[model samples]
Target chain A: MDLVVAVLFQLIYVIANLALISLGLAIIFGMMRVINLAHGEFLMLGGYTVVVATNAGVNIWIAMLILAPLVVGIVGVIVERLLIRWLYGRMVDTLLATWGLSLLMVGLVTSIFGASTATTVAPPLGAIRIGSYAASGYELFLILITIVLLIAVWLTLRYTKLGLLARGTMQNAEMASALGVSTSRIYMVTFGLGAAVSGLAGGLLAPMTGVLPTIGATYIAKAFITVISGGSAILAGTTAGSVLLGGLNGIFSFIAGSTFGEIALLLAAIVLLRLMPRGITGRFFRKSL
Target chain B: MNSGILRQMRPTFVYALLGIIFMFAAPQVLQLFTIINLTTAIALAVLALSLALIWGYGGILCFGQVAFFGLGAYAYTISAINFGGSTWAILMAVMITSAFAAALGYFIFFGRVSDVYLGVITLTVTLIFFSLIRRTSGPEYKIGNALLGGFNGVSSPPINLPWNPTSFLFPEQVFYVAMAALILCYVFAGWLVNTKFGRVCQAIRENELRAELLGYDTRLYKLGIFTIGAGIAAIGGVLFCNGVGRITPDVFNLYNAALTIIWVIVGGRGTLIGPIGATFALFYLTSALGGQSVLNNNLVLGIILIFFVLLVPKGVAPTIIDWVNARRKKAPGRVRRRRGSRGEGAQ
Candidate 1:
């Protein structure tokens, strides 16, 4: 019973992690139709923000919760204004340009901080006991935070004015423009919001994974897989995709090992894509956001 | 009609003549190390050409072309160890890689996967290959006589003289072979783009729905071009391993994949000559940067990519072509002929 409980906790954590990493991409790619290949870099920047801040004697909680996202959100705004705004609707060009941006970020980070940085910050809150098994308290916190984050995103999209305008613009930019909405500014804000969300996820994960410029490469693939498998409904699809893929990954990792687990996740995604190329939400939640 | 045919063939004929001359004359002027570097660059140009063929012409922007490249290198290395020869190994590499691509491409194109999903799936496959190969560093992962050296990579057997397996080609000889292959592949690609099949593929790229309405099997054409491109990249991988005398999991890394796309984009897509020139130019530029250690190569490359994508999206070749065409438009007696040729070229 203890083993089952522990495994379940781990599985939920995995799903939450996937959802957190993918939510920003879900908004940017799913909502805006712009494939930001530099997404992983955005996350990396967030992680670095936390690390740099904490190292400079700032509180860890503040760094991760506030500073990271704020800094990365500003960077995201700059990126949008400088690069992304010019290449809207050109999907392939966006992919190429953002890939270049990713490389540039990696290079700049490497040159500034070297290949790796010494992260003194560790996963906070320590360990928690669950019957015969013990789990990281930080992991539990992460799970809770992910749930809160998802709900917050859902609420904002459902109720907020910015969210409403963003959704309207995404659905029909020309129509929204005729109604006197500044679609360009909406795009900029939405992109920055997505970046900010990504930054927050990166900051949150930093303590567990540590910060490396190259770490983005690892996160980018899984995040993309999650978002692509999630289909078009940003929030609901991301949740569904994450649950399915993350559950498979966690269960397989528990049964076999991490390598096979990863392979299994990728294989499952491939099969899922073959069956439903439009993604899980594309087939199931056709009406839901 | 004869004059039209002659005019059409003139550029290719001149290109072939220049390539042959350069192949023989380059070694005389360059040092051995420079020649070897050129050989590697030529191999990469072949890789770029493969991408140009698919993404540029076929309209399939595959992010994982390096999967086939790495597969080819590994296949060649493994097969060479088994056969104790290079000729059969090269053939095996190309065949195995292309077959794998065909299978994967079938699953992708035939499955009606969207463009974004296609990119993700291909990139995932590449990462899987990278991670899978990296894990095979154990002594138990031996294939035939070759040990999958894991992350350490294996020292590839150099290409031997086809008639004499005991005699390996010197770096100079490899340079000659690489140059010759580049020329042959370039000419072959040029000829292909002018063929009926190529036109259909381009038509499908322009409008898949329209092509389907016209009774063309867009999926089949995509798969065909993708497989052919994979085969060409495999050949490039074989040449690359021959140049460096090694094969590693690094070939399948995301950095290399991005670099390949950068080469194609900076060189210009939709044209054969653009990617080739861009590959050579950027290869040398990075090498120079490495030597100088002034500015970071990735940063420079990133900026170049942004600049080209934003301002010079037509790429160097097409831009040059456009400039020349503008110049010719001012000249008398040739304007009408140029317009006629331009219309045909556009199609």
Candidate 2:
């Protein structure tokens, strides 16, 4: 009974982690139709923000929760204005351009931090005992925070004017413009919001996984898989895709070890994609957002 | 007036002639170290050519091209270690890699996976290969005599004379072979792009639905070109192993994959010669940067990519062709002739 509860907790954490990392990408891709390959780098930059701020004697919580997202969000706005603005509607060009941006970010960060940063930040909140098993209390905290973050995003998108306008712009930019909405400003804000969310996730994860310049490479693939599998619906698709894929990953990892676990996740995604080329949301929740 | 076939073949013939001359003359004029470096670049050029064919001409933007390259290298290393010769190993590598690509492409193209998802899927597959191969460090991961050395990589057998298996080719001889292979592949690709199949592939690239409506099987053509590209890239892997004398899981890394795409982009896609030129140029540029230790190679490459995409989207070859055409039009006789032709056409 204890083992079951422990596994269940771990599984939920996995799903939350997937959802957190993929949400920003989902917003950028789902809303904008701009496949920001640099989404991973935005996460990396967030991680670096935490590291830099913490090193400068800021509180860890403030660094991760506030500074990380703020810094990355500003960078995101700048990027949208400069790079992403021109490449709108050109999908393949966006892919190439953002890929170049990803490389540039990795290079710039590597040069500044010298390959890997010396991170002294460890997971806070200590460990929790789960009968025969002990789990990190920080993991539980992350899970809680992920839920809060998701709720916050859901509320913001649901209740806010910005969210409504952004959705309207995403659905039809010309129509939004015709209705006297500044579609460009919405795009810029939406992109920054996505980057800020990614930053927050990265800042939170930095304690768990040490920040390396090239670490974005590992996250980018998984985020892309989640977002792609999730399809066009921002919140529902991301949640559904994350739960399904992350649950499979967690279960497989528990049973077959990490290597097979990864292979299983990839195989599952490929098969899922084969069956539903437009993705899960494209097929099932055709009306859901 | 030039015949249709001859006109189509003219650029390739000229390039081939220059390549042959350079191949024979390079060893004499260049230092041994430079020749060795050029060998690696030549191998990479073949890989770039494969990408140029599939992504540029076929409009299939595969981000996992290194998977086939790495697989070919591994297959060659394992088979050579087992068979005690490279003659059969090279053939096996190409065949196996192409088969693998064919299977993977079947699922992707036939599944009607969108372009963005296709890129994501291919990249994910490449990462999977990287992570999977990186775990084979254990002693039990041996295939016959060759141990899958995991991240440390395995030393590959050099190509030997077909009759006498004992005598391996030296670095200089290997350089010659690499140059010859590059030239042959370039000519072959040039010939391919003019064929009826290539024309259909280009049409599919332009508009898949239109081609489909015309009764052409877009999926089959994509699969065919993808498999061929994989085969060519595998040959590149074999040559790469011969150049470096080793095979490692690093070949399947995201860096190499990105670098391959960079070569095609910088050199200009949709043209065989452009990527080849870009590969050699960027290869030397990175090597120079490595020597200097002043600027980061990735930063330089990133800037170049951005600059090209924003300013020179047509890439080097097409941009040059456009410039040359503009100059010719500005010439006195050419301007009058062109205007006269336009007037005649209007009439």
Candidate 3:
């Protein structure tokens, strides 16, 4: 009974973790249809922001919660303005360019920090005991935070003017422009917001995964699989996809090993994609945002 | 890929001539080490050529091309160890990789997966391979006494003479084999583009819906080119393993996959020789950077990608061709002829 509860808690945390890493990518891809291959780099940058800021003696919470997102958000805006703005609508070109950008980020970070970064930050919360086993209290906090983040995003998209404008622009740019919405500004803002979310997630995960110059490569394929498998709907799709994949991954990791877990996640994604080419939400939740 | 200038002479003839010349001349002038490196570069060029045909011409943006390349390498390595001969191992590698590609492509193309989704699926498949291979370090991962060395990887067998199995080929002989394969591949690709099948593939690339309406099986055509591309990439893998004298799981990495795309993009996608040229240029450029600590290779590559995408979007060969065409038009007779051509409906 104790094992079951602990397993369930870990599974939920795993799902939350997947959602946390993938939300930003889901939003960006869902809105722009421009698959940002540099999404992983953005996450990495956010992780660095926290690491760099904390090393300079800032509070770890503030660094993770605020500075990471802010720094990466600004970087996202700049990247959009400088590189992505010109490549809008050309999906393949955007992917390739961002891939290059990803490599550049890895190289730049490696040069600056060297390969092995001295990670001085640790998970800030104490462990919560589950029967004889103890689970990291930070994981519970992360799960709560992810829930809040999802709710916040949903509220913002459903009720906020900017969200409406952005969604409108995404759906039909010409129509939005005709209705006097500055579509380009929305694109920039949306991209920045997505980057900010990714940054926050990265900062959050850094304590658990640690930071490396080339760590983004590991996260990227997983994030891409989640986002693409989620299909078109942003919040609903990502949530659904992450839960399914992350749950399976957690269960398999517990049962077999991480390798098997990874293999399962990837295999499930491929089969899911083959079954529903447009993704789960693309087929099921055709009306959801 | 008909870079008008390259095609000015019979492309096959020109490729054959150049290939033959380089095959003989390179070993004489270049260092032994450089010749081996050139062989590796030639392997990559063939890989790029495969992409140029499928992505540039067939309009399939395969994000997992190296999947087949790695598969071929693995197949060749394992088979050579088990079969004890390079002759059958090479053939098996090509056949296995092509069959695997065909099977994978069948699911993707026939299932009507959209373009972007196709990229996701292929990439996923490739990552699966990478993940799967990285864990085979245990003795349990063996196929007929050939251990699938996990992270450290296995050393591929040397190519022995067909008649005398005791006499293995030197690096120079491997270089020769690589060059001959590349030239043959180039000539074959040049000839392919002019075929009826290739023409249909191009038409399908231009407008899939239109081609479908015209009663052509676009899926079959895509699968055909994809499978063929995989075969070419497999051969590249064989050459690559031969040149390096080893096979590792790293060949299935995202970096190599992206590098293949970069070569095609920078060298002019629609031109065969362009990517081959780009492969050699970038290959040497990276190697040169590797010898130094002053500059970062990835950063340089990133800047180049951005610069090309922003400015020279048509890539090197086509950009050069356009410039020459512009200059040629400045000649009095050419200018009059061009002007007369444009004079058709001025009013």
**DockQ of all candidate complexes:** 0.63, 0.72, 0.61
Candidate 2 chain B: worst 10 consecutive residues by lDDT? B338-347
Order of all candidates by TM-score, from best down to worst? 2, 1, 3
- Candidate lDDT scores, in order, read 0.87, 0.86, 0.86
Q: Write the per-residue lDDT of candidate 2 for residues B43-127, one digit (tens) a residue.
A: 9999999998888888899988888888888999899989999889999999999998998898899888877778878988988
Clashing pairs in 1: none
TM-score of chain A of each: 0.98, 0.98, 0.98
Query: Which candidate's DockQ is highest?
Result: 2
TM-score of chain B of each: 0.94, 0.94, 0.92
Could you give candidate 1's per-residue lDDT for residues B1-347 as a string of tens digits?
24544455456667778889999999999999999988889989999999999988888989998888889889999998889999999999999999999988888888888676788788878888888788888898899899999999999998998857799999999998988888888777766666677778888878999999999999999999999999999989999998998999999988888888888888777877778888999998898898865577777878887888888887887778778878888888776653343322321
* TM-score (all chains, Cα) for each model: 0.96, 0.96, 0.94
lDDT of 3 at A276: 85
Candidate 3 ranges beyond 4 A from true positions? B1-9, B334-347
For candidate 3, write residues A111-162 as lDDT tens digits: 7888796474799999999998899999999999999999999999989999
lDDT (10s digit) by residue, model 2, range A1-289:
9999999999999899999899999988888999988988998998889988998999999999999999999999999999999999889888888888988888898778887565758876798999999999999998898889878888887889998888788788999999999999999998999999999999999998889888888888888888888888998889988998899999999998878878878888888888888878999988877
